[model samples]
Target chain A: MSSTRKSQVQSSKVASEQIKTQKDIDMESDEDRNDENRNDNQQQSRPKLSIQRQDGDNTNATYSFLNEDHTLGNLLRNVIIKNNQVEFCAYSVPHPSEPIMNVRLQVAPSCGDTKKVLKHGLKRIAKMSDVLTEKFQNALDKYENRMSD
Target chain B: MYGMEQINTATGFANAKFGSSKGQGAKGFDEPEIRILELSKYVIKFELLNTDLSVANSLRRIIIAEVPTMAIDLVEVKENTSALHDEFIAHRLGLIPLQSFNVDQFNLSDQCACSSMCAQCSVQFKLHAVCSDRDQMEVNTRHIQPLSDAPIIPVQYVNDKGIEEDPILIMKLSKNQQLDMNLVARKGNGKIHAKWSPVATCQMRKEPIVEIDQDKINRDLDIEKRKEFVALCPREVFAFNDYRNAVEIENSDKCIQCIECLRFAQANNLERAVKIAEREDKFVFTVESTGVLTPEDIVSRALQILMRKLYELGTQMKKYGVNAD
Candidate 1:
C-alpha cells in the first residue's frame, strides 16, 4: 500500500510538471505571436509618403501631393464630385507605405470671383492633378521594384 | 399867248403822231421776247469758278524755300570699296576731296521763299577730305527729314567701294551715295490746297438733327448744352410734342437729311436715334459763286428761310390768338 501511494504521488508530480511545461510552452508561443503583431504594426506605421508638384511651377500655380500607391489609388477611386467644372481627381501617398490622400480640383474660369478650394484657392487645380497622377504612378513603380528586390 | 399855244400844239401833235404811231406799230408787231427769255435763263444758271491764289502761292514758295536749306547728317555706313584711297588721290591732284559726306540738318527759318516755292531760296552742299595713306574707309549715315512727307521715314546707307579702286582713292559723290533723302516739297499746289474747300461748297450733306423725348427735352436742355454736339441743331427742334412730355420733330418734311440729329444724340451721351436718308426729289440748290464764302454764311441763309416760314406761321397764329411761347 505505501509503495502504491508513493508511485501515485510521483506520477502526479510528473503530470503537474508536464502541465507546467505545457503552460510555459503556450505562454512562449503567445509571446512570440504578440511580438510578430507588434512588428507588423511598426511596418504599417512607417509607410513612406511622397510629394510631387504637377506642372512643376510652370503652371500659374503648382500642386504637390504624395506618390500614388495602392492606398492612394484606392482613395482617388472614391472621388464623389463629378461636375462639369471638375477637371481631374488624384490620390497621392507621400511614402510607399503611407496612407493615401486624395485631392479633387477643377479649372476655374479666369473671370469668375469664386474662391478656389484647392492649393490656396487661386492656384489652378487641374495642373496639380496632373502632377499628383504622375507622382502616384512613379511611387507605385518604385513600390513594385522594392517588392521585387 | 394864242400864238405860243398854237406852236406848242403843232409840236405836240407832230411828236405824238411820230411817237404814238411808232409805239402802236411796234406793239402791233408780234416779235418774240428773246431778250427776256435770255435774261430769265441767265438768272437760273449755276456756274462755279474758284481761284486759291494765296494758298497755292504760299505752298509753292514754301517748297522752293525749305527744300534747299535742309540739313543732313551721316548716321551709319558699310564699307564695300576702297573709295577713301581714291578720294585721297583726287585731293593730291589739287581737286577738293569729298570729305565728311553727311546731310545738313534742315531748318525752316533758313528757307528762302518764306514758306513759298521760289527759285532764289535753295541749297547745295559740297564736302572734301584727304587721307594720309591709301586705305579703305566706309561710311554709314542716317538722314532725317524734319518735315516728313509721311509720318514715318525709313533710311539706309551702304558703301560700294571695290578693292581694285584701292590706292588710287577715287571716291566720287554719286547719287547712289545718298542714303535717304526724305525731303518733301511743301509747295501747297496739290492735295493740300484742294482739301481746303470754301465752306459754302464743302458743306457735308449730312448734318445732325436732335430729336429728344418730348418729356425729357425741357428737363435735359441744360445738360444737353454741355454735350458734345450742342451746335448740331437749332434749339427750337427740342420743343414739346403733343404729349408735352417729350420732344419730337416739328416738321418731318423740313429735315435736310443732315446727320445733325444723330450727331447731337451722340454728343448728348445718347444712342443714335435718328437716321438720315437721301431725298431724291428735294434738290440741293447750290449757288456756285466765284469767290470763297464762310460756312456760317450759308448756314445763316438757310436759317433765314426757315425763320421767314416760322414768322409767317407765327403771324397766322397771332391772328388766331395762339400762344407762340
Candidate 2:
C-alpha cells in the first residue's frame, strides 16, 4: 500500500509537469500570432469573429464567409440583386478545396443599409418559397379530389 | 380617351388596359420614351415613344448608313491571268465584310492624325495564288492575308465542318491563272457606300393596342360563329384553343389597328367585339445587323452619336444665349 502511494505521487508530479509544458507551448503560439497585431494593446479585448471584410469602403463592401460554400453565396447574390438598389453584386470561391465564398456587393448611392437590404431579400425569398410550397399542396389536394371524383 | 365604354368587364383583357390614358401623354412629352424590348447576341428590338416620325426615320437611316466599317479600298495587282477582270475582282473584294470590333481604336483614313495613310487607320493585305497543277483551283477571301498583326482583319469564316470556310471565290484558275496582289483596307462609314452599313434592316412602326370583349362574343355567338370571328382577322392575331374552348390573342403586337374585326362585327350584328388602337406616341423597332457589330451595338452607337450631336448643339446654343433648355 505504501509503494502504491509513492507511485501515485510520482504520476501526479509528471502530470503537473506536462500541464506546465503545455502552458509554455500555448504562450509561444500566442507570441507567434501575427507580427502586425503583436503591438496591438487591444488584441485581448478584440472579439474572435469568423467573418471579415478583405476590402471595401462606404458604397462598396466585400465580405468573406470562410466555411460557407458557393451554393448559399450564389442564392444570396440572386436574391439580394432583386432589391434593385444593388448596382452590382458578384461572388467568387478562391479555390475548390478552400470552401470559402467571397461576396462583393456594391450598393447604389441612394441606398441606406446594405446588410438590412440583404436580410430583407433573404426573408422575401424564404416567404416566396413558403408560398410555393403552400400552392403545391393545394394543387396536390385538388388533383386528388378530381381523381376521387 | 377614345371612349373606353366597356372597361373593367373582366370579359377578356379589360383589365389589361394600362391606366396611361392621361399620364402617358403628358409625362412622355418631356422625356422621350425608349424601351428596348428584346436584346440578344446579334439582334435587338425596341420601341421609341412620343417621338416625331422624322426623328425615328432619321435614327433608322443613321443606324444603316452612319455606322463605320473597314473595307479594302485600294488593290495593287502584280500578277493575274484569271478569267475575272482585275477591277471586278477588286470591287468584289471591297464588299466582303471583315468581322471587326474595337471600333474606337481605329479611325477613318482621312480622320487619322497622320498626314497620309498609316497603320492606325489602315491595314495592308497581301494575297498570292499560284496553281501549278492541271486541276482547277479556287481562291477566296481567306487567301487575302492581313500584313499587320491585327486578329480581326481578314474576317475568317468557319463552317460546321470545323474547317475554315471558302476563302471566297476571288477568281477561278485553270493551271496557270496565277494571282498576286497587295490590298489596302480603310475605315469608312456606310454614308459613302452601303458596303460599310452595319445594319441589314432597321424598321419602326406605331405600337398597336388590342382590345377584346369576350363577354359579348362568347355568350351571344355560336361555336361556328366564334370560329368565323377568330378566323376573320388577318395576321393571325387571335387563335381558338380547343382545350380551353377560348379565343385568345396569340400575338397581339401584330395587330395593325385596321378595324377589320370591328367591321366584321358590325356586319354580323355584334357590337364591341374587337377593338385595336395604334398609339400615336409609341413605336416598335426591329433591327437586324449585316455583320461585325451586333444589333445592340449598332442601336446604342446610333443613339450615342445622336446624343453627342445634341450635346454639341446644346453647348453651341449656350454660347449664343438661345435658351436651349
Candidate 3:
C-alpha cells in the first residue's frame, strides 16, 4: 500500500508538471491565439474596418480594414486621391498571411475630417461598381444572344 | 484626372471613352463600358473603357480570388492499396475543378447550421476504382460519383466536333489495386485555397497608344536612316511605305512600349517623331476558365462579388456614422 501511494504521488506530480508545460506552450504560441481570434472574428461577421486618428490631427489618420487586400485598397486610395481636399493617400498590406490593409490619409487643412473623404470614396466605388455590374450583364446577354443566333 | 495628355494617332485614341482632365472629382467620372472582343469555350477577351486602373485591377483580382466555386475539401479514405498515399490522393482530388454553376445553392461550410457538414453546405461524392482484369487501370475523374442529387460533377471538356475529350486522370492502379473514398465538396473562394479558384487566368493590360510623325521622319532622316529606324522596332510597328517613300505606322496596337524606335528617333535628333504611351482609362482583359464555369459566367459573378463588397463597405461606413455629406 505504501509503494502504491508513492507511485500515485509521483503520477500526480507529473500531471501537475504537464499542466505547467501546457500553459508554457500556450504562452509561447501567441500566433495561434491570434489565429483563433481571427477565426472567431470571421465567424462573427463583424464590421472589419476601423479608423485611427493621429494625435491632435483630425486631418491625418490611418484606416485599418480587416479581411481586405490590394483589390479594395488601391480602389479606395485612387478614389480618395481624386478629391481635391485629400493631399495624399496610400495603402499597404501589412502582411501577406494577415488579411489586413492599412490606408494612411492626409487631407488638406481645409478638410478637417478624414472619414468624410473615406465615406465619399466608398460611396463612389459602390456606385461605380453598381453601374459596371449592369453594363457587364448587358454585354454578356448581348454576346450570348448573338452567339446563339 | 490622372490621365496624361496623349497625342492622337492617325486613327485617333480609339479605346478611351472618357478622358479625365485636371481638377475633376469622382463625380465627373463616367460609367465604365464593357465591350466583348472575343468569347470562346475557355477564353474571353474584353475591353473595359472609361474606368480607372484601380477598377480594372480590382475586377481582375476579384475574378481570380473572390469568386466562389465548389471543390473537394475533405476526404474519408476507407480503403486504399494504390501506390499513392491517402493524403496525396486527397490533394489531387481537391485540385480537380467541379461544375460550380449552381454554387449559390450551397452555403459556405463555416456559415452553415450543421455541426460539421450537411446537404445545404456540402456535396458528398464517392470514388471507387478496382483493377482486376486489366493489367493496369487508369483512374480518371469519371470514377467520382455524386452520392446525392447535387448538381456538382467533374468538369468535362468537349472538342469542336462535339466529341468528349480525355477526362482528367487522378491515378493509375495495377492489378488488384483499388481505392475507395468519400469526398466532401464545399463552396469556397480562392482566398482559402487556390484549388477553389474558378478561373485559370484573369489578366488585364493597359491599351497601348502609338503615334508617329511621318513628315518629321521623312524630312529629318535619309532613306538609310529611315530604314534603320523602321528595323529598330521589333513589333513591326513602323514600316517604310515604298510608294510614298516615307516611314509610316503599320500596326500601332501591336506596340508593346519597347521604346526601341523612340530611342532611335531621339538619337537622330527627332525628339517628338514617335510617342508611345498607355491609356489610363482603357484596359484590355482576358479571362480563361478551368471549364467549371463559362468565361461569361465567371466575369459576371466576379462583378457581382465586387459590387457586394463595395456595398458592404458603404453600409458599414454609414453605420459608423462617417457620412458627413
Which candidate number has the best TM-score? 3
lDDT of 3 by residue, B9-42 (tens): 4223322322235334455567679989889888
Interface RMSD of 1: 57.0
Pairs in steric clash, model 3: none
Better of 1 and 3 by DockQ: 3
Task: Order candidates by TM-score, high to low.
Answer: 3, 2, 1
Considering every candidate listed, which one attains the maximal DockQ? Answer: 3
The interface root mean square deviation of candidate 3 comes to 12.7
Query: What residue runs in model 2 are displaced by over 4 Å at the alpha carbon?
Result: A1-149, B1-29, B32-36, B49-55, B113-116, B157-171, B232-234, B243-246, B256-263, B318-325
Q: Return the candidate ranking by lDDT, descending.
A: 3, 2, 1
Q: Can you tell me which runs of candidate 1 are displaced by over 4 Å? A: A1-149, B1-213, B219-229, B232-264, B267-269, B272-275, B287-325
Q: What is the lDDT of candidate 1?
A: 0.29
Which model scores highest in lDDT? Answer: 3
Question: Each predicted complex: what DockQ?
Answer: 0.00, 0.01, 0.23
lDDT of 2 by residue, A47-130 (tens): 221223334444566655544444346655654554446666677888866546777776766774455454454454333333
For B5-113, candidate 2 gives per-residue lDDT tens digits of 2233221222211223433333222235565566555567777764444456656766876777777776677777788877777778777777667656788765579
Each model's lDDT: 0.29, 0.62, 0.82
Binned by DockQ into CAPRI classes (incorrect, acceptable, medium, high), candidate 2 is incorrect
Which runs in model 3 stand beyond 4 Å of their true positions? A1-46, A54-57, A144-149, B1-27, B218-232, B239-247, B266-271
Q: Is candidate 1 or candidate 3 better by lDDT?
A: 3
